[model samples]
Target chain A: MYLAQIHVTYKPSILDPQGVAIKDAMHRLDFDTVTDVTQGKYFEVTLSADSAADAEAEIEAICDRLLANPNMETYRYDVKELANQ
Target chain B: MYLAQIHVTYKPSILDPQGVAIKDAMHRLDFDTVTDVTQGKYFEVTLSADSAADAEAEIEAICDRLLANPNMETYRYDVKELANQ
Candidate 1:
């Protein structure tokens, strides 16, 4: 088994309104030090693949085709082996 | 400035229907190797703080009060100092 930890985040150019709202909320609650916030999605996936390289390739394909909206987001992932699961 | 990267995830005992849905979608799309999927929220918050330890403490407070549901979810964070921004 191999496990993939993926983070899908908005591109730098994108404006994140939800992040702005969170910052404002934080300030209202007196966390005045908060300056900025960026929100994103995290996924942990477990799969069986022939090799580490294969697992990474599969994860990339999954992100590109299903997990992320390529026009608005970019994703990065780490893949590692899991023994006998 | 200090940056805190946070991840909020469901407790292992909690059921993640969205994750199950995503895994099913993956399999239907022919990615049968997928065995499990776990989805969570990710955040990057930038704040002005006196020190990294203070920043981490603040981040933990924010997570406990706002970002996570104590009964269902748990959170972890990484804090680091950033060059003048």
Candidate 2:
């Protein structure tokens, strides 16, 4: 089995209202040093594949097709081998 | 300035409907090797601090107080020094 940890974020040119809201809140909380905030999605997935390359390809396809919206967001992921459990 | 990359995840005991939906989609797409999926949040923040330790503490506070729901999610972050951008 392999575990994939995915992180998805908005493209730099995109506007992120949620991130803005959080940044404002942080400022209100007196963490005024925070200049910018960009919020995104994270996913942890467990899967089995015949080879590491296959697992990575499957995950890349998954991210491109479902987990992220190509128009506004980009994603990256790390895959780790897991012991049978 | 320092960039903090935050990742928040639901505890193992928590339910993740979005993840389940994605997993189902993956299966429908014939990636049936996928066994489980857990969804969470990610954030990229830019801030300035006098020291790395201070920046980490500030981010930890932000996660605990605002970025993450203490009752449902746990968070971790990595801080990197920026090249002044």
DockQ of each: 0.96, 0.90
Worst 10 residues of 1 chain B by lDDT: B76-85
As a whole number from 0 to 100, the lDDT of residue B21 in candidate 2 is 94
Tens-place lDDT digits, model 2, residues A1-85: 9999998989989999999998999999998999999889889999999888999999999998888999999999999999888
Candidate 1 per-residue lDDT, tens place, A1-66, comes to 999999999999999998999999999899999999999999999999999999999999999999
Q: Which CAPRI category fits model 1?
A: high
- Compared with the true structure, the alpha-carbon lDDT of candidate 1 equals 0.95
Q: Against the correct fold, how does model 1 do in TM-score?
A: 0.98
Clashing pairs in 2: none
RMSD of each: 0.7, 1.2
